[model samples]
Every structure is written in structure tokens, then in C-alpha cells.
Target: MNTVIDAHNISKVYNPTTIPVYAVNNVHLHLQKGEFTALVGPSGSGKTTLLNMIGGLDRPDEGNIFINGIDITKLSANELISFRLQNIGFVFQSFNLIPVLTAKENVEFIMQLQKASKQQREERVKTLFAQIGLQDKLNERPSRLSGGQQQRVAVARALASRPQFVLADEPTANLDTKSAFNLLDIMAKLNMEENITFLFSTHDQRVIDRARRVITLVDGRIVQDTAEVSTQHEEAAAVKT
Candidate 1:
């Protein structure tokens, strides 16, 4: 698989002169096309900080970030924003869906920003919703949908721009057991069948078990990196316990 993202000696800090805190230490990580990985860590372990840098939501104080071989670290603010929209998708912990928009509209929002045609947007939304088992709730607004339903819709929206990769921060944190399993099923299926690349920060054991690659971060540094794990079918089954 081609390398989709590369971070070299990345670091981020806040309040350098005062009570200095390193949100992300000199950490390095990479992701490949069609890879499903989980960034597991304790609270304040720098998972979100690393994700924000990769997604271009924030710039690291030191080190370089390259996505698709493009050195994102060199891009200006405006350029970075444009590049991110064209290349990366983000699913925040909060659904962040517009209250007034229906599920279809929410998914169409990003495509609209990309100036995609109505037909194209509709086609993509229809296919994604069906794949995620949300075909019937297409017309429902976030307020009307359950938390899981809303999260599924958010995932669909993340794919609206057809980004190379999706970054999900604690995606299943607010869901019940059934909802979490359902969402995981959709995500794992998308990774296996559609070859959608996903890199999410999660503390859920179930989510961790489902990931093909598990990267553990501790105190802003990567302490363990496990890749090339075997098929997780058995693990997934056991996690449903």
C-alpha cells in the first residue's frame, strides 16, 4: 500500500515559557492506503494532538508532515486549509452536524463545498447511507436520530469529499454497546470492502481489538507500535462478550 501520511519528528507544545506542556513530543507515525489503525492511549496521551496535526487543523511547532508526498508543513494557512479539504476528512467526538439539516443535507454539505454536482452528491450520499444501514433515516435530522445514527451520518459526511483518509477522534465514546458494535461493523466493513483508510483515536477495548494496527502512545510519545496483525475476526467475536 502507498503511504498516505508521514510525520517526521513531530512535536507540539503549549506555554513554552510558563508551565510548559508538550501536547505531542517528538513522535513519528505514518499510515498507508486502505489501512485501519487505532491510536490507543490514556487521557492527555497526545492522540488528539497528533491527529490535529495530521488533519491540518493545527501545525506542529517542530518537524514535518507530509500527506500524499506533499509537505503540508510548508503550506501557508490558506493553502493548508484548501489542501486539507481536498485530501483529509475529520469526524470529531461530537457529531457537529447542523441541527436544521437532514441526514442527506448534512452529508451533502462537504460535497457542496467542493462544488460537486447535485447528482454526484446525491449518488454518493445514497450509496454511503445504504452501506452504513442508514438508508431509511436519510430525511431525518440529527435531533430526530439516535446518537449512533447521528455518528453514522457523520461518518457518511466525512466521506462526502472522498478524502484519502478519515480521522475519527473517540468515535464510539458516546454510544451504547449495541451502537458501538454496529458502528464498528460499518467502519470495519468499509475498510475491508471499500478500502477506505481510517485512523482513529480510541480508548475502547472493543475498538482497539478490531484495529488491524494498534499504536500505543504514552505521555505524548509512542511506546508501542503493532502492525501487520492477523485477521481480527476471532477477536471481534470475543469482544462482543
Candidate 2:
């Protein structure tokens, strides 16, 4: 598999106080194309900090991040912004939808920033809303939608730009069990069907169970890395024999 993201000796430190605190300490990770990976850890374990560094939303105090073989640390601010907009999608624990905008409008917002043609934006937003089963609610604002619905809209927005990789921070944190599972199912389907890589920082067991690979972090260090055996892959291999 082609490597989609790579990190080397990444570290982040907070220097507000007399003594510096290392949020992420010399952590390294690599994610391949089409991989569904869960970055699992407790609060303050540096999962989010690591994720932010990978997404280019936050820079590491030390170390380097390479996305699609480009060293992100070497990019200027404007170049980083352009790279993130073109190649990365983000989903947050909070839906992060603008309350005033309708679902379709919210999804269209990112495409608009990318300077998509009006017709193209309309077609893409409509298709995404339909895929998320929110076609009927596309005209409704976030305030009018349920938590699950809002998150679905957020997912649609994240995919609007057709990014190769998505970085999600506690995406299922606020959902109920049913909602969380449903969201995971959608994400899993997308990961397989679209061949889009997903990297998540989550404590949710549902999210972990759905992941093809799990990386556990404790106290700013990776403690465990495991790959789940896929039954479908096994079955296909058996059939060919």
C-alpha cells in the first residue's frame, strides 16, 4: 500500500509555564492508503495533539510530518493551508456546523472556498446529502436537526472536497450508542468504497472495533499497535484456493 501519511520523532511542548510540558513526545506513525486507523488514548494522552500535527492544523515543536511524501513542516503557511484544503478532510467531536446555514449550504461552503463552479458545487452537495440520507433535511439548519443528523451533515461537508485522507478527532464522542454505531458504519463504508483513508483519535469502542488498525497511546507514547484480521479478506483468499 502507498503511504498516505508519515511522521518522524514528532513532539509538541507547551511552554507557558516555567517548566515545559511535553504533550507529544517523540511519537512516530505511518498510515497507508485506504487504511482505517484508530488512535486510541485517554484524555491528555496526546492523541488529539498528534492528530492536529498530522492534519497540519497544529505544528510540532520538533519533528516532521510528511503527507503524500511532502514534508509538511517545510511548507510555508499559505502552502500548508492550500495543501490541507486540497488533500485533507477534518471531522470534529462537535459537529462544527454553522447554525445559520442549511445542510446543503454547509457542505457547499468548502467547495465554494475551493472555487468550485456553481453547477458543480450544487451537484456535489446534493449527491453528498443524498448519500448521507439527509436529502429531505438539506434545507434545514443545524439547529433544526438532531445530533446524529448534524454529525451526518458534518461528515458530508468533510467529504465535499473529495480529500484523499480524513482526520477525525473524537468524532463519535458526543453520540449515543446507536448513533455512534451508525456513524461508524457510514465511515466504514466510505473507507472501503471510496478508498479514502481515515485516521481518528477516539476512545469510543465502536470506533475502535470498526478500525482495521489500532494504535494505542499512553502518556504521549505509542504503547500498542494491532491489525485486525478482516473476515472478507480471509473468505476471498479461501475462495481462490
Candidate 3:
């Protein structure tokens, strides 16, 4: 598989005073195209920091990061911004929707940034809203929607740009069990149907069970990496027996 994102000997340090805090230490990771990966760790484990570095929101102090074969560490600020807009989408724990914007408007905003035509943006947003089962909530503002509904809107906005990769930071942290599972189901379908790669930083077992691969981090370093066979594949093997 082609590598969508690659990191080598990456490290991040936060200078609070005279002492520097090592947030990430010598971490290396490679995400293949179409892969669904979970980064699981306890508090202060640096999973979010790693995701931010991969998403170009932050820079690594000690190493290089390449996304789609381009070394983003070498890019200028303007270049990095453009690269992020064109290649990556992000879903946050807080469902970072503009509260005043309607669901449809929130979804259309990113496409507008990409300079998509008004008609194209409208059509795309309509399709996405319908796909995420949010068509009825199109005119609702973030404040008007339930937590799950707002998150569905966030998911729609992330896919608005048709990005190659989506980085989700604790996407299920605020949801109830039913809502969390629903969001995971939508993401899983999107991953399979659109071939969009997803990387998540989560401690939730629900999210971990859905991932095709899981990377466990401890004390700022990856301690274990494992791949699980998909349920569909497992069922097929059983049927052939």
C-alpha cells in the first residue's frame, strides 16, 4: 500500500520555563492509503500531539513528516496551510461547528474556501447531509441539534473537501453509547465507501474495536501495534470452511 503519511524519529518539546517537557519522544509511524487506524493511550500519552503534527497543525522539533510524498516539515507556513486545506480534514472532540451557521452552511464553508462554485458546493453539501442522515437537520444551527446530530454535521463538514485523510481527536468522547456507535458506523461506512483514510486518538474501546489497526502509546512512545481482521473477512473464511 502507498504511504499516505509518514513520520520519522519525531519528537516535540514544550518549553514552559527553564525546563522542557517532552510531549512526544522519537515516535515513528506510517499510515497507508485507505487504512483505519486508532491511536490509543492514557492521558498525557502524546496521541493528540502526534496527530497534530501529522495534520500539519504543529511542527516536530526533532524529525520530518511526509504526507502524500511531500515533506511537510520543509514547507513554508502558506504552503502548509494550503496543503492542509487540500489534503486533510479534521474532526474534533468538541464538534467545532460555527454556532451561527446552519448545518448546510457549515458543511458548505470548507468547499467555499476551496473555491468551489456555488452550485457545486450546494450539491455536495446536500449529498453529504443526506448520506449522514442529516437532511432534515439542514437548516438547524449547531445549538439546535443534539450532540450526535452536531457530530454528524461535523463529519459532513470534514468530508466536504473530499480530503485524502481525516484526523479525529477523541471524536466519541462526548456521546452516549448509542450515539457513539452511530457515529462509528457512519465513519466505518465512509471509510469503506469513499476509501478515505482515518486516524483517531481515542481511549474508547468502542472506537478501538472498529479500527482495522490499533497503535498503543505509553509515556510518549508507541508500545504496541496490532492489526485485526475485518468481520467481513472473518465471516467469509468461516463460510468457506
Best by lDDT: 3
Question: Model 2 lDDT vs. the true structure?
Answer: 0.89
lDDT of each: 0.91, 0.89, 0.92
Q: Worst 10-residue stretch by lDDT in candidate 1?
A: 227-236
Sort every candidate by lDDT, greatest first. 3, 1, 2
Candidate 1 vs 3: which has more lDDT: 3
Cα TM-score per model = 0.93, 0.91, 0.92
Instruction: List candidate 2 stretches off by more than 4 Å.
Output: 227-241
- Candidate 1: stretches off by over 4 Å: 228-241
For candidate 2, the per-residue lDDT at 198 reads 93
TM-score head-to-head 1 vs 2, winner: 1
Residue pairs with backbone atoms closer than 3 Å in model 2 (clashes): none
**lDDT (tens digit, per residue) of candidate 3 on 1-241:** 8899999999999994769888888998989989999999999999999999999999999999989889999999999999998999999999999998999999998999999999999899888987899888999999999998899899999999999899999999999999999999999999999888999999999999999899998888998877433446778899999
True lDDT of residue 39, candidate 3: 98
Q: Give lDDT tens digits, candidate 1, residues 114-229.
A: 99999999899989999889999999989999999999999988888989999999999999989989999999999999899999999999999999899999999998888623
Query: Of the candidates numbered 1 and 2, which has the greater lDDT value?
Result: 1
